[model samples]
Target: MLEIHQFPCLSDNYGYLLHDPDSGETACIDTPDAAAYLHAAQEREWQITQIWNTHWHPDHAGGNEAIKAATGCTVLAPEIDAERIPAVDRIVKHGETVWLGEWDAAVIGVGGHTNGHVAYHLPDAEMAFVGDALFALGCGRMFEGTAPQFWTSLTRLKALPPATMLYCAHEYTASNARFALHADPDNAELQTYAEEIRHRRDAGQPTVPSKLLRELKTNPFLRADNPELQARWGHPGDAVATFAALRAAKDTF
Candidate 1:
């Protein structure tokens, strides 16, 4: 079994260290903070051996050089964003596979947040390291891709097994829940889920690693194709248009 060590670093970023004990290989999902990642690995007595970068964002790949220099780990990043990311030893495209011991992770192209954003999905672990692509109740902003492209990216994620656990990189669930409720005011499941998110935040607990089953029913961004959402957002039958409207609204909201 792969062991994941999650810890808070920076202001809202969640650092993930994926460990495969059988091969003694540890991979940093993203290099949000080098010092924090190094300290966390040291405390757990795990040697960092690889880095899997999801995008070119500074917060996601800023610590790459430092961590690599310290651990001599190999860095794998999205091929499309290779020019922007630092110290990438391997550039992986969508459908390509990366390995940690005997376990394999598929690279999923999720290019809305950034033009080359990618997600690492481990089918065996039933989890995905989704760096700012899909949030608990929201998706990343359309920084570099079109709504159609982003919706397409999300469609791939929505196709994942319902039991898949989404390990998003931020702690934005509370705020996202607020927007989700506003977007889908009549969704009873969303109301319940929002309330749970509130309680989780009040207790100072992390709301990441959300289940795909719950998100499928609640995340407005992911529900753009639903007739109700398309009608509600005034897009009628266009999922891409509806997604565009929702993203525009959230940017100002």
Candidate 2:
């Protein structure tokens, strides 16, 4: 079985360790703090075979070099961002699968959070390591990509099985839900979801590994075609436009 554990790094950043106990192989995702994860892995006595990256964000890839130097593991990243990420040994593209023993993940180029951002989806595990792309109840801020591009990418991701568990890079569920509520306060579903999220957060638990089905039901960003959101945006509005306004509100919120 593939056991996935999360390490909370640099306040809200989450670095993941995917371990296949049968194969005894481990893959580390987005090393924001190399020393921290390196130490933890060493203590666990697991072999760190590969380091995977979703984008070139410093917080996401900053610890790549340090961990590589210490562990001598192969680094896998997007081919487009090779210039920014010098440690990339295996430059992968969309449609390629990075095998982890019995489990293999298909890399989908999900740009919009960044120019070269690509999220990895493990179909067998039903997991998505979305770096700064889709959050719990909201999407990542449009930094390097346009709203249309983001919407398209998100649409592709949404096409996946609803049971697919999203493993995003940050722990912004509570805050994201707050913005979600502002976009459609009249949405009782959103209100209830936010309340549950707050309760989980208050108990010091992660409001994550959220299923795509749950997100589709309560998330305003995912619910672009929702009647309530359309009513709030005053009709005939694109979801991207609605999202842009929601993001703006969040910026000041």
Candidate 3:
């Protein structure tokens, strides 16, 4: 069985520690803070054997060198961003598979938030470690990619099984809920989910590891193809145009 440990790091970032008991291999996905990851691993008596980075953003790969120095762990990241992530030991590309003990994780190219952003999808575990690409109720802002490119990336994630659990890097659900309501105001599921998100945040709980099915029902960014949202945003029938309009609105919103 694969055991995942979740903890807060660097303000809103959430760190993940994936442990495979069968082989005693553990991997840290996206190092937001090396000290936090080290402490968490020490508390669990699990040594970090590898690091799977999803992007080259400072918040995502900031702890790479520190963590690698401490654990002598192997670091794997997208080859396209190799120059940005100096600590990467193995360069991975899209459609490649990496093994964590006996479990396999498919590396999916999801370039939107960053030019080389990727997602590590463990189909067998029904989980995905998406960095700043896709979020719980929102998607990442296009920093280095275009709206159409981001839309493509989002569609790829939407293709995953509805039951798949997504682990995003930041704690942006509370704010995302607000935007979702604006874009999908008439969606009953979104209204309910927004309330739930508010309740969770008010109680100081993390609204992460959200189910993909729930996202499909509530996330406006993921529902760019919905005619209602398109009409509400006045983008008519073009999904890409609707996505760009929403994203532009979100840039200032």
Compute the lDDT for candidate 3.
0.92
lDDT of 1 by residue, 173-197 (tens): 9999999998999999999999999
Model 3, position 82: C-alpha lDDT score: 75
Consecutive 10-residue window with the lowest summed lDDT within model 2: 234-243
What lDDT score belongs to each candidate, Candidate 1 first? 0.95, 0.83, 0.92
lDDT of 2 by residue, 1-253 (tens): 7888787899898878888988888888888999878877887888888888988888888888988898888899987766787488898887789977778999888888787788889998888888888889978887888877877788878888999999998899998888778777887877888999989999999887889998888777777766668668764457777666666667688
Model 3 scores worst on lDDT over the 10 consecutive residues at 79-88
TM-score of 2: 0.94
RMSD of 3: 0.8
Best by TM-score: 1
Clashing pairs in 2: none
lDDT for each residue of candidate 3 in 1-253, tens digit (9 for 90 to 100): 8999999998899999999988989999989899999999999999899999999988889999999999999999898887898588899988999999999999998998898999999999999998989999999998899888989989989999999999999999999888888877889998999999899999999999999999999898898998888898888788899999888888888
Q: Give the distance in Å from residue 210's predicted Cα in candidate 3 to where it truly belongs.
A: 0.2
TM-score, each model? 0.99, 0.94, 0.98
Query: Which stretches of candidate 2 lie above 4 Å from their native place?
Result: 235-237
Query: Which candidate, 1 or 2, would have the higher TM-score against the true structure?
Result: 1
Extract clashing residue pairs from model 3: none
